[model samples]
Every structure is written in structure tokens, then in C-alpha cells.
Target: MPALNAEKAIAQEKAIIINTESLNVRNGPGLSFSVAKQVHKGDEFQVVSSENDWYEIKLNSSKTGWVANWLVTLKAGSSAKKGTVTEDGLRVRDGAGTNYSVVAALNNGEEVSITEEQGNWYKISAGSIAGWVHKDYIAGDAPETEDSETVSNVQPDNWTGISTDNSLNVRNSPGLHGSIIGKLNKGDKVSVTGSVSGWFRIEFGGIEGWVSSQYIEKPSSASKPPANQVSYGKVIINSLNIRENANLNGKVVGSVKQGEVYEILEEKNNWYKLSLKGGKTGWAAGWYMEKTVAEKPQKQQSTRKAEEVQILYNGTNLRSSAFTNSAIVARASSGETFPIKKKTGEWYEVSLKNGQTGFVASWIVSVSGSSDSAPVNKPKSGGLKGKTILIDPGHGGRDSGTIGYRGTFEKDLTLSTSQILYDLLKKAGADVILTRNDDSYSSLNTRVALAHYHDSDAFISIHYDSISDSSVKGYTAYYYHQYQKELSQTVLGSLVKSLSSRNRGLKQGDYFVIRENKQPAVLLELGYLSNPSEEALTRTHSFQDMAARSIYNGLDEYFSE
Candidate 1:
């Protein structure tokens, strides 16, 4: 099983070749899976890619299967020593140094058969996927396989662990912001089904939930928090109070907003003691902070010059391949800059600081704003500070809104979009209140009432439009009062620029939230769920993130003005 300290990965996947006789190729990705075929150590196959410690080789035009990269080796080259990959997301450069281009990436515990060595680079190869990895990150060797029977039986067992701390929270999802669903007491036995981002999924009391791997004890994963080892935590909520104590009534020492980070000094009773400036410390609620879990040594900012092109907003998708439908390599955060390597019709190939390349949409890069291509790092808290933004997800419960061309519920989409918007706004330093954070329903009156009661600076009613004509696909903003016209136009302007959607234009419409509310308000029909293509696009994580970011950017502009 993978360790908790490792960076966010499904699992590690790197290896080198061997010259052993008659090696078994697995039908599946792991050793425990059935063998598909046998090949000599030097037998070559068309190498496509690697994932989760397995090499994908094309058997024929239509057929493909996984093989252990450990069993395959280069026919001519002989290895000096077998090594282990020490870091997650370690660059496999074309040469040994940072100047070299990244040919591939290695994850923690991956096999590293060093064929040759020069300075800091080692010639590591497993068939077609061959490159030089840094020597400092190559550990001694992967565990030697003594026998076939023993190797075939190697698989991770489901974790049976005892809770080491009192009241270990089990969340609905992996991260700290995932709502708390239950708790486990000290010494209680629990079984782990999975792990992601340093959190373990376990089944308890008829609920499958996740808990921090830190407070749980499994013989293999059992370890205590290191002394003087600090973790960087990004604020997950808008404007969290940094207090003098761990309790609610503690004196407010300082304030931090979304996109802000601090070094954690200690953790107690669901609160984090933060290392503030001038060597002082302050306590903040842990539930509003997301801890970084990077096992690799942190890469420093590039001393090289900046690129001309930069992402205008956060949640921008970075594709791994040239093809438009390729796998998402990563998500670029706002204000995080990258030098443009080149540009095609629709995509911008950007060189990341990690020495790897990724493609982003040109439309996103071209959307110049007040902070367009800002600095490469995430920006400090901005216009969202002290702003009370009410987000009303349009429909819920029995009110499913319009049915999409793909049968997607409009209520579900609204809720999903609003939830993401809430996070972004909170992180940006807004006191964001969601009318319905879950599947529950809220009457229009209640939603409007909530905004008025909070004395909200701005109110946004999020919905998706539908039409009988499937050809019609676009986003629109509506305002019921003259006061909301500017808000509607500003937000819709941002949506049109940042997203690849048609602008249906802002219209004066009698929407209850906008008409009845005294605050500056707008109702956004983000997209036409009835359009098959647009419906499919709206459901993606990338699109949802982009939509939320666009709206947040619009609000930021409104508040700044």
C-alpha cells in the first residue's frame, strides 16, 4: 500500500527493465492479477505509457494490456544497480540537470534500474519509456523478488487499525472541508478500504467515510507526527479568525482569507495553532484549512524569466496531450503564472515550473483582466474581504429543475456549481452563505430572507436554462431591478470572456431573488442543460470550476469598483 506522506496520487507508477527469462505479463495492473502472456526479458513491445506501476503496451491495433516494467529491460544496455524512486512527481529529465527537459515523471517507491550515471542524472529505462532521473532521488533498490510464487501473492491487505486518538473525525469526503459525518473514539478498531490525500476511507456504523491517517494506527502506516515538522495549510473558508486560543471565544489575533496559507505549529481539539509573523502563534479552526501532503522535497520558484501567456483565472484545465479530449494533467490556480512554450488554434502549451509541459485553453489565457497573468503564485486575499455573498443554488429536493439532454438534474448541477463557488469565495475572503449546500430544498422567500438577514452585499441565484430547441446553448444573466443591471452585466461579461460559452446577453427579468432582494443581485442561467453538447461540458469538473471562477472574478470586479 502507498504511504500517507506521499503526494496526492492514485498510486505510484515508475520502473526499469530487467533481463530475466520468461517474465509474466499481467492481464491487470498488479502482480496478484492473472498473467496475460510471457515474454523474454529483452522482448520488445510498442510502449504507450505508464500508470500505477504498470506499462501499457499495444498488443495489436485494437488490443492493449499491462506488463510489469520491472520484468522488461533494454536489450543492449546493462544496469549498474536497481534503485527506488524516493520522491513523488520527480522529474525524469532528458539529461541529469534542471536545464534538461522532462521526458517523464516518477512517483515514490517506483523501481529505478540505473543503466548509466552522469553527475546528478541516472540513465533509467524500462523499454520505450526511458530517461535520466536525478541521482539524489534514486534510493538503493526495489525489494528483490526471490520466487515467482511469493511475487504473485503480493497485494495490499485491507487495513485493520485501532484508533490512536480520541474523537478522530470521519468525514464524508477525503479533505478537511468534507462535512463531518461521524467520529471514532480511542482504541476503536476500524478497517481502511482506501487512501487519498493522506486520508483513509473506512467503514464504520453502516457508513463508509474518511478519516485523517494521522490519528489511526495500522502496523504499516503507524507513525506519530514529527517534532518541528511543520505543514503548510491553505485556508478553505472565507476569512477565518486567527485566535489566541483554540476555542470559539478566543481573542482574535489576526485574520486570513481564502488563498492564504500558514505554517502549522500544532493541532489540538480540531484547531490548528499557526505560526504567525514575528515568531508569534495563533489558533484557527482546522476544519477550514486544507493541509499539504507532499512527500517530495518542495521545488523552489524558478529564477528564470516569466512567460508572456498566463492563466486569467483559477480552475483552468491543463491537458496532458495535444488532443483536445486528452487526460487532465493538472489544474492551474489563479495568479499562478507559466511561460508560454507556444500556441495552436485553441490551446496554449505552457512550460510549468516543475520542468514539465501542459496545454491550456487559449481562450482562458487571452482573457485579460485586472490581475491577468498576475504573479506565478496564488494571490493574497483580495476584494472578497469583508464581503457577504449569498449563493442561492436554484432548485432542490422535489424541485429538480429542467432535465438535461443526458438526464442530468439541473438541481444537482446548480448545487455543484454553487458549492464550488462557495469554496472559491470563502478562500478569497468572503463570508459566503449558501442557500442550500446539500440536497435540501429552500423556498424562494427563505433564500431571499437569508440574504436580507445576513445584510448580504451581493446575492447570486444560480440556475441552468433549458429550451425545446437543442441547438440553443449559451449562458445568461437576469436582473429584476435597475440596481442589479450593472451586477448582471459585469458577471455575464466575465462568464463570456473566461468560458467557451455563448453570451445570450443580460436581460431584465422578474426573478424573485433579484426583484425582492434589497441587496445588489443577479440570477445567472449558466448554460443550457437541454443542449446535449453543452450539458456534457457543464458536468465536467473543469467546466464547473471555470464557471465558479468566472462568477467570482465578476464579483471581485464589482466589489473593487
Candidate 2:
């Protein structure tokens, strides 16, 4: 059945803008040559190309630009087809709306510019940031044009890969629970062919295997790995004083000392087994220093610049080939280092310092963002500042605490609200502590461990209220021991005072994070997830600010007392 809606019916007769203000350019679809100027909201234009969500269009007297598919309503007697923009931005392809190109986002309440006319598409300018939109999403207008272009003429040379935090399963076969040959990290590039049940078969390191296409970038034929070539890579240690051994183990094989150079040979597991000066071989774990984890160190046999790359996370699988379809060579974790042998589009063929070679996902590991990326390493803070408090976001990754209404995951909201609190506290000048930084799940013990590690003056865990009802509201605060009564009271009082919701008040509750911590600890349930309105509001920045400010002010009052 045809996808239909209110917007479609209205667009059939209108000429308007979508994703207003997009600058069309010559690079990609939305980035083609800039033609016309900005089309204000509710303005009309003539469309030239009508592909997917993008309408290659020109204003009646204006040049041409692309507009998003969502921003327009139809004008009576307009010759544009009918369509509606979904909640999320839709894709806009080139040619005859066949093979889809990358997606162009069209936010709510935005207008699309129209250029040319097609059966259901109006080519228009989406603005300088994002380009065009299809006419199908335009409400109240319609126009008809020829299906003139083919996909072959406008396809891109390279396919972009997105980052996936989780370690992806690489299988020898293409089915569920297929033999787990190895695993791939986020950003690893692959050459795609036939897909089996949503699974994509990719070519990596000369081997072919299947991986879920959902996590990484889509495979395209235009992007292919280069032929085998040697490349050189250097080892980078986070701690400047990494110790070297005579052998693979820390057997004091005579310390090469930090910053000493060694010849590359082989990479295994997370260790770079190196060839020392006297023909002796010694091994160092990749974690000891930031070194590349895939492929053999590129010997100078081939000339290639040393590429600075970081491991995305711990335990990324290294493949013998550039595609996930290749054979498994080794495994690497975050902070490991390596050199690039060659790059095929987005995937880089990398060699470990110790000489092992393989393919690793590029997006999972940041090529530029380093742990030391922040300038002037601030001394890890001591206790939450008396003025600003840091709220540690808890249970990211696999450590989701409890499930709430409509499957509102706890980890998502905890981190979400904590981030809000962190920003508010920091802006307000209170020193804060974040137990864990990213979504990688941390243990409960780690929560208190961070507080003790930083000697935080006070500790607080932010959570959402969850009861059987799908429509309950209010906020609550919990403390495990009596010693934390003052801290809890201050936070609770401020929260109750600031928020426009029911006050569940302070209660005695034993939580592992509070029970095990040395400093004053409090856990807050700021609102009920079961209530639809409250749940939605809790997800927004405004409500979070209210909570953060309330907590901050509460801390101020408590410390003063």
C-alpha cells in the first residue's frame, strides 16, 4: 500500500520549501553547486529534480537549490506530488528516486524549497546546511515531471561509516548464532554484496563474512580496499614511563626504558611483541602504551605516512583484511595504537607497532580525540565543590538498573539527567565528580570507587521514579544511612521547592552506591516514568535544569547549615 497521510494530501497542490535555508553544492547530493538564494518560510519555487526527499528546484525567478521534503504545504493547482515527512528526516536520492543516497534531516516546523517538478517530487533548496527535499512530504500541492535520471550517473564514490559503540559479532557463516569466527569494532569498513535476512556480507582482509548492517555504515561497491602494501606505524604510550622487558612478560629483560625505540615484528592479542636491539624479542601489552592493534607494523618496504589512530574501546577484533569478511588476526582494546597500511574509502588497513597487520573499525576508535585531548590536564578534583556538585551518571552499557514504564530504560534517563545536572552544577561553580564518563557500563562498586578516588564531599545518584502505574507523577530522594540525612534533606528540599511536581519527600533506602561510600550519599528519583507527560518532560533540558538547580541550591543550603 502507498504511504499516505495529511501532509501528502495537502502537498499535491502546494509549492513551498522544506528543511529551509539549505545551501546546495557540488560535493554530495545536498552539497551540490550552490545555485539560488535562501527561500524564506512559505515561499514558492520551481523544482527541477525530484528524487526521494530532495527536490532539485529553482524559484520562479531565482536560481536553484535543494529543500527538505517536510517543510512545505501545497498551493492550490500546484504541480507537485503529495508526501509527508516522518518524525525523523528522510533520505533524498538523485536521478529517478531509485537507489537512495545519504539521508538529509528535516526537523519539525521547517519549510522546503522547490525547484523542478516530477511525478511526486519538487526540486527545491533545503538551504546551505542541508540541501533538498522530495515533494511527497509537501502538504496540499501537486506537479508532474519526467522520470529522467538514472542512479549510475549520480552515485557517490565512497560510502560513509557511522560509529557503533558495541563490539559487533563477525561470523564465519551468515545466520543467527553463526559460528563466532571473530568480532569487529565500530568504524571497521566492509565491502557489501548479497545480504541475508538484514545481515550484510562484507569482504575484509581477503575473507568474507556477515555482520549486522545496522551497527556500521552500509557497504557500497564504489568503495574497495587497495592492493596489499607495506606501511609504517609508531607506538604511543599514555604514560610516558612505560617499562620494557627482555621477554613478553615483565621479567626485567633489561628495561629499554621509556621513549626508547625498538624494531617492529609481530602483534598478538593486546600486546605488541617487538624485536629488540640485540635480535632479542620483548612483548608489551597494547594497554601499557597507546599503540595500533591490527596488522603487522608496516615495514619501510613501502612508503606511507604514519597515521595516528586510537582504539575505539577495549577488545576490538583485528582482521587480516580490510573488510569484516576477512579472517580474524587478533583483538585490541581502547587506547591501543597502530599505523595505517592503506585506506579504502573509510576503512583503513592498519599495522600494529609490533608488525601484526589487520583491519579495525575506524569510527569506534577516534583518530583525533585522545584521552589527553583536553588541554591542561586539570588535577582530578577533590570532593564535589561546595558550590557546584558533580553527579556521576551510572549503569551505562550493559548495566541497566531497573526497567520502567513502556520500557523506559533506566540507564538512558540516568545518564541523560546526570549530564544535565553536571552542566548545571559546573555552570553554577560547584566542583563535580562523574563516576563514569561514557556509556560503557560501570560496576556499582565503581560508583563509590570514583567518589573515594576523588574524595568527593558529597555523592548523589540521579534516577527516575517507577511504579506499576503508567500514569503516576512526583519525585523522591533516598539515603542509606543516618550520616547522610543532612545531605539528603538539602537536596530533597531544594528539589521539592524548585520543581512543579508532587513531593515524595526524603526516605530511608539502602542503595549499594550510598551504603558503600565514605562520603555523604543521596539517591534521587526526580519524577515518575510511568506518567507520559512527566516522562516526556523529564527527557527535556528544561526539566533537567530545574532538577539540577534545585539540587545545587539544596547543596548550598546544606553546606551552609
Candidate 3:
């Protein structure tokens, strides 16, 4: 929470790169240093000294690399600039000049700096920047007053020695390349227990780990609070490169969203094995998710006019009527602004600047004078015009019901196929309900609840079959409740006829989604995941369309009866 001013002199400082590009090193102003290795944009570095356009920096520990001055900026605020506590907090600006952009504002007395001055703005080279703060807002810049007490007692002995410049590696084991976990940034404090071949055995984020001594600085007696401890109670989505194993080149499963909550069940090295609230468990790197709430600007005047609403997506058209078939009068691009004149159902009558009036789906456009926005159409389809079917893709996140042979996750395949099917149904004038759109992990309860909540006429779960035998192939329909038997049979027959693979036939299953679903529900295993040939074919456009057409035919047949 300390203000990071670029100019505030501190015994130590760390620069965490936010830009997702590398900082290329070039020999120039300070030619006295030998440089090696490219500094990836997000990599953190320790500031040893700065003169002119070149900075003498240490990256990932042992190596002394000269970083280009502009690519990597520093933060400046510390306790000394304002007697350890000033009445006003510092601001973070984009650049060291007055005209720089304001990246973030700070609370009063927060630790940050007033490193230098360019015109009216004082540069606080900290985590971020603040631009053009009034002189009155500036606080104490005088050196440490006599009243400044030595809080070194709060500092752990030799803990501060672990700087970001060390070859510090968070690993699954104590030795080299043992699943390199998290990268240690400059000024990161960790309690050292032992050392091996320039590797420091340190306790990191409540887990015992090893960091290369080359990347860490010598321990300082100065005490600062250990970087905020990870709170285990709240859930966090993994935001960094999360792999199956804790290795650098490990295959990425997927990234966890920032600010997502997860329950921490265990910790090893720098990996926090977490249990998601949705009953899914996964390992995540400790360095990625920061646990801090930033205060956002709440009082800025409305930059947009009350009559203008921005378009959410491109190809948005103004139709004659609220219906999708009302006939397009005009098309709007993404971010186009328009004024709403009236509302009919979920559609809005928007009057364009050229005096043309037509209806737009309100969900796709935001109200100009208000902060509210809505989706153009709610996923819930009310009209059962052609065929009424709810396609629920099961087990989002960790509950991926089954895994395919070629490493195609069930969650992904189901959602992909469901989307194609939904589009097909829509184009055919069939009413459809897709439980979810994106790769969000959802629970079976939620999936079933959605179908019943929408009063869907029928519910079908989409999935790819997986088995130990790579030869097992073809589509299969599963029905639990007897009411869904007729629908399942019809869909199954069409799938077997439409798809070229072996027919698995319709069978009864106690699948949780179908058994508990309030509406008539059936689960479909469209293809075998273990069969490589089938897997490849299942992923094709032709196969997806065939599956959709088959399902539609089956629905039509069932409904006709």
C-alpha cells in the first residue's frame, strides 16, 4: 500500500514489469558494463544504480544486465520522504513529465515517492504513475527526520537479503529445474533456512522452498513487513501460466481469471493447490495473483452523452421491428453511439443521427447517460417456434465429466459443439437454450436448474465419450427419466444415421445432470474421445454440422409425434 515514487531514495527497490513485452538491452550512455540475456517484459528486476539512459540492473539474480532506460521505469515512494507517514498519499503517473497519463491514485500517507520533477509533476517511480498532481497535494520530501524510528525490529534478520536480482526459483524440489515455480522479484523477503550450491532454501509464502542465491541480495537487517501473506480463506483464480506440472515448459491447461476466488487446500514450494468453489482443484503459481483492492475513480463526469449508447459488437443492425426478422434498416459497428427513443420488449427504438429510426436489441447496446449495459439477447430463448430444446454442456472447469484421448477436454468440446448446434437451431427457427457460452466452469446443478428455470420443453447434455480403449467409437444418447425416452430415441437414431462413425445406440444412464433435471433431460455422448480417427473427425466443421443437423432432425421427429 506504500506510494511508489520514482525519486524517493530507498536502500532497495524492485521493478515489476506490467507491459507484456521484453526490455531490450542496448549499449549506450553507460558503456562500462557487460550485458547478457534479454529481459522479458514482465520480468522484474532490482535497481543497483541508474545514470542517464542506462540502468545497472540485476535480473532473476546473478546476472548484471543493463536495461534500456525507457522500457523499465522505477517507483520512488518510501517512509523517508514523508517521515514514514505523510498526511496525503502520492499518485502514480504514466511518465516523469506533467503531461503524462495518470495510471492510478493513492490513499493518504501511502508509501510512494516524489523521485524527480518535470514541469509541474513530481515523478513517483513506484509500481505505477500519477500525472500532474497540484503542488498542494504534494507532501513531505525532506529526508528522514530525527523522529524517524528504526522499525528494523519489524524487519526479519537476513530476510530482506532475498532480492529480486537473485536466481531465485520457486520449485517443486530443492534442486535445479525441479519444476521452476514462481520467480522472485526484487525486494521480496523470505526467511532462509539453508543453502546449497548458491541456492537458498527459503520459506516462501508459507511454503518451504529453494531460491538460487545468485538472484537474491544479501540479507539486510532492515525490517519491512514480509510482503503481504496469502490469505487462504478466500478463493483466487490462477492468473499466471498454470501448467499440469510445476515446470516452465509444461503444457498450459488454461489461465485463471484475475480476482477470481478459490479455496487454498495445500501449498508446496511456490505452488498453491487450490480447490475452486465449483468443486474443481488445480495448482497455481504464487507470484501471479496479487491480493489487493485498488481504489478506482468514482466521481468523474460522464464523458458520454445521455442520448448516445455504444455498440457492444460489430454488425449490429437496426431492424424495422423488435423481432430478429424485422428487416435491417442500418448496421452499426462496435462502439457506435446511438440515441434510444423507445423500448418494445427487449428491443430499443434507436433514432440515428441521419434521422433514420429503427429497433436494436437493447442488450447489445448501453444507455448513453447511464452506466448500465445489457446483452442484446438473453440466452434464455422464450419462443418455441420451430423446435424447443435446451442444450446443456456439462461440467465446466474441473468437473469436466470426461476426457478425450487426444487431450481434447470435455468442457471445451461440448461447448464448441453446443455453439454450432445452437446456431443451427436458431437458423432453422428452432428455439434453443445453451446453458453457457464461454469456457466457464459450471456445476451440474446450475446446468439442470437453468433448463427447468427456463421451462424448456426438453433438455440435452452434450459431451464427447472417453474410454481406455482407443478403438471405442460413435455417438450414444443417454436417457434417465422415462419421459425423455422418446426424445432420446429420436435424437439417437438421427445421430447414428447422420454421423459416419459406428453407432453406440441409445442407453439409460444415471448421469446426475439428467436424473435431477426438472425437465425432460437426456445426456448425449456424441463421439468417442479415445479413438484418434473419430476425435479428428469430431473436431471438423463437417462433423459438427452433421451432429447439429442430426439432433435437429431427431427433435423435429420427436416433436411431430
Give the clash total for candidate 2.
Answer: 122
Q: What is the lDDT of residue 282 in candidate 3?
A: 67
Report the number of clashing residue pairs per model: 7, 122, 60
Q: Which stretches of candidate 2 lie over 4 Å from their true place?
A: 1-390, 402-407
Weakest ten-residue segment in model 2 by summed lDDT: 142-151
Q: Write the per-residue lDDT of candidate 3 for residues 247-295, one digit (tens) a residue.
A: 4455676665532434444444445566553566666665653221111
RMSD of 3: 22.2
* TM values, all candidates: 0.34, 0.35, 0.36
Best-fitting candidate, scored by TM-score: 3
Q: How many backbone clashes does candidate 1 have?
A: 7
lDDT per residue as tens, model 2, 460-483: 888776654555689988887777
Candidate 2 global lDDT: 0.53
Per-residue alpha-carbon lDDT of candidate 1 for residues 1-561, written as tens digits (9 for 90 to 100): 111222323312333343455666656554334567766755566555555345666667887566654345422233257776656787888864465698888776677667754433567874466888766566563223221122124333486776676447776655543445656655455767776546677765445677777888885565655431335565645488998887778889899765355666665545678876678889887656655422111112224355445444468788997666999988886446777777665567888778889988654443222232211222323577988899999877545566676456788789878888999999988999988865555656567656655667788999887766778999989887776788888899899889888988988875446755666789999898778899878977689889999999999988777
TM-score, model 3 to reference: 0.36
Off by over 4 Å in 1: 1-382
Lowest-sum lDDT 10-residue window in model 3? 291-300
Write down the RMSD of candidate 1 (Cα, Å).
Answer: 24.0
List the pairs of residues colliding in candidate 1.
Answer: 13-53, 17-72, 17-73, 18-72, 238-426, 258-427, 337-376
